[model samples]
Target: MLNNVAVAAVNGVTPFELGIFCEVFGIDRSAVGLPVYDFAVCAAEEGPLVVGDGHFGLTLPFGPERLEEADLICLPADRGAPTREYPQPLLAALHRAVDRGARVLSVCSGAFMLGAAGLLDGRRCTTHWMHAPALLRRYPRALVDPDVLYVDEGQIITAAGTASGIDACLHVVRQEQGAEVANTIARRMVVPPHRDGGQAQYIRRPLPRTACDTMGEVIAWMARHLAEEITVEQLAERAHMSARTFARRFLAETGTTPYQWLLRQRVLLAQELLESSDETVDAIAGRCGFGNAAALRHHFLRTLGTTPNAFRRTFRGPQAA
Candidate 1:
């Protein structure tokens, strides 16, 4: 129920993931009947902030003073930062925020910061894929699930690296503002509204339904009709099963819920288009059944934790942008 969010733009700000915080939670969406946040970008040391890839320098009038007012405090990822020694002043501010009922979050390696502070001593969290092992090794007391995009533990949350932060942010939105508002933001951002964590993270080979028969027809249909209005009942009817029966069967066969399976297909298609096709995000969203670029961005953030542009840059090679 707090209105403001203060995101820490630490040294060597990964501009893209930090920007995800701006897009999802920072910008006012009240006109669209979504919750609005009082967003401020603050630096530990005020004035000229250096960004990744020599992007831009930013300055903020307020430093950590804004932390006292924040309902949520964000620390963007730092791949190169220390795992065990977060500065004392920042840790104190984080401790103070948490003590006062504010939630503290980190993106990717930002979990390292929280872990180092001893806050994650008994919590479950995640970080970027590459750093997950190190994080778990560094904090054995921390239960780290490396494959999921993000983890939500009510008062505290942590996300997988980079774009996974966006997923964590959307999760917050859904919790605070409800599914409708979260969907609206997703529409505006051109991203998928929700992607359940149960979806496959490393689906190298698509699992077939059986040795002879397959749910192949249904999955293809689901992917093709992503923009169409779908319901459990609708899908169940297509498969000639009752809703209850189909829900159970779907989870058993696909290892995820019906809605989640559709979302994963949409994300996969979007990833392909984002990589192989030269289409803009908006066009890709429409093509991939996300409705718009905003909707695509929402899902992309949830699954990948980075913006379309940023993802494209990385996909095209580190130097593309």
Candidate 2:
């Protein structure tokens, strides 16, 4: 049902994020039996729009009126500072699109434009974890969850960082066309159909440089031994520190306890295995150090709010089940 699509082009838009919108919706895949959207990049102002470097620019054929025909509108991240104001015409078109029941999606800091449009007010949304604080300060009425890769608030979808834009697009495809279509598109892109966890697990929240001499080395060792059951006492021995000091330093450096970090790593590994391999739940559970299917299920549900098998089905299809 989501056939028409439009990407709002603003000055200072990041070329890569804008290309994500073009890649997902602008391309014609109808020969392979995929939906072909009526897509265009629309500019708020009429004339040559300057981009990143002032020397280079784009000339969009359509204007903000094009957004009226779109079933979905994509806002790619702009390099303009988060505090900069978007064109009022572009924001008004966005408001009209949503008022007519169309969906709007933002990639990374594009959430700033949505916030400017007042679309994110009182809604759960997200942007890149690095910019989440600024977004929260700018739009206090908006509920920002920096942990997740993306947040789907019915008509509005806000995604984190560059690649999560693909994930968010594929999610909309899966919702509209089903898992099979989404999987096929992902295959064409050579990216995972789905990924687990939030940007929390991916953000490089490393220990302080001073502390990394000891804690960092242990963290690297822990990553290598994710499949093995690790105890903080054993880790303390390995670090040549007492249990209390090890625990204290672990929290200070990693911002999480040893057990919590290990559990998150295990869950992340399980997710990768579930998406990439046809292995049974028990096999994956053991491989990820969960020991059994039930344990994997418990942790998967706890972390992702879904069972492993269900997650697999959502990504790999029912036949995989």
Candidate 3:
């Protein structure tokens, strides 16, 4: 159902997110046998646009009218200035896209544009976790997730950060073409076909020195061992501290509990295998330590807010796997 792709950029479009969109949808990947999109960059008003990069600027010839022709519209990670108001035409076009079945997507702060259109009202959405508070403050009606890289609430999709845009865009690829194409594109881009971790896994300065020091290394081990039932007690044992101390420290270190961390990692691994490999739901669940397909679906929905098959279809496409 997806074909043409368009990126909506206003006056202050951030270069990193613009590059992310261009990397995923703007490139010509026909040589890899993927469907080529009708890619265009549009602005609220027609004129030359100065991207964040000062070296060069992009002159856009199209306006809000161009978004109507796209099957997918990508909004960059940066939006309006804090002291300024949003352009009316861009918001209007966003509404028009939804009215016509055009998928609306936002990378990081771009959620603002979609929010302004009232498209995210009552629907789960996300932006960079750092901006979650501000977004919630501004758009109280929007359900924002601060832990994941992205949230796909069926029609409108929103991603969590500057690089999180890559995850969101790869998702668009998976939805349009298939898992194989998405993986191929990911390889070309030199990023994981899908990130096997979440923002919760990277809580930043919150983690204490000793615990935070080995957190990244520990995460790698945890991801590799999800198929085995590793308890908080066991994780604490491995950390060489008492269970009570470990539990408290882990919470202070990760902003989440060991149980929550394990569940998220399990689901992320399950999603990756489901997309990149030809595996059954039962097998994927078992491999990811979910015990069974039903259990996997339950956790997937509880945490990621989506069903396994639906997630696979969005990330792996309609293949037999």
Candidate 4:
């Protein structure tokens, strides 16, 4: 039912984030039996708008009026979104869209625009991890979850960072159309058909300082030996420290506990095997140190919100799965 789509562009919009919406919805992909959207990019502000980095300017044909007919409205990240004020007309359009049951999605800092419009009030949403704190401070009522790739609150979808915008858009497609249509579009785009919105964003943490690089070596060993049973006590011995000290240092360095870090790595390994190899789930579980398919399934579902077989089908197609 989501046939009409519009991207509301303001000055200083990030080109890559804006392109995410254009690629996902604006392209004509009906040749493969996919639904073609009536899409437009509307300038929320006056013409000759400058893009991020001031590299170029855009003169859009559509304006806020185009948003009136859209079933969904997209807000891409803007360089000045954190502090800049959105146009009154644009904000009014957003409120009207949601009031009429149309969805509004924001990519990265574009959530700031939604916050300005009061659309994110009392809604659980997210933005890029770097901007989550500012978004929360600016809009105190918006529940910001910084870890996930996106948050879907029915009429409002907020995606974290850059590529996660693709995930959110495809999710909307999958919801409104079907998995086959979403998967076909993903294939055409050469990206994943589905990445769970709940999946953690890839945030890099600084390594913990150590006098002799012992903890670094231990973590390297842990990654290398993920297929084997690992214990904090054993890792502590290898690092020449007590179990408690090792656990504390691991948490400080990785921002996660040892068991959780291992579980996440094992799930990642299982995903790689599922996509690249023909190994049975039991075999993969053993290879990843899960010991059995049941354990693998439990942890995989907890971490990725999808089963191994389903993930394989998503990446390798149904016959491959």
Residue pairs whose backbone atoms clash in candidate 2: none
Q: Could you give candidate 2's per-residue lDDT for residues 52-99 as a string of tens digits? A: 556588999899999999999999888884978888989888999999
- Residue 74 error for model 4, in Å? 0.6
Cα lDDT tens digits, model 4, 170-234, are 99999999999999999999997966524441444343344546577887788889899999999
What does candidate 4 score on TM? 0.69
lDDT of 3 at 167: 94
Q: Give lDDT for model 4.
A: 0.89
Q: Please say which candidate is ahead in TM-score: 2 or 3.
A: 2
Q: Cα miss at 108, model 4 (Å)? A: 1.1
Deviating ranges (above 4 Å) for candidate 1:
82-85, 198-321
Global lDDT scores for all candidate models: 0.75, 0.88, 0.79, 0.89
Clashes of 4: 0
Select the stronger candidate by lDDT from 1 and 2: 2
Pairs that collide in candidate 4 are: none
The numbered model that scores best in lDDT is 4
Lowest-sum lDDT 10-residue window in model 4: 201-210
Q: Arrange candidates by lDDT, highest first: which order?
A: 4, 2, 3, 1
**CA RMSD of all predictions:** 12.2, 6.4, 9.5, 5.4
The better-scoring model by lDDT among 2 and 3 is 2
Could you tell me the lDDT of residue 39 within candidate 3?
90
Q: What TM-score does model 3 achieve against the real structure?
A: 0.64
In TM-score terms, candidate 1 sits at 0.61
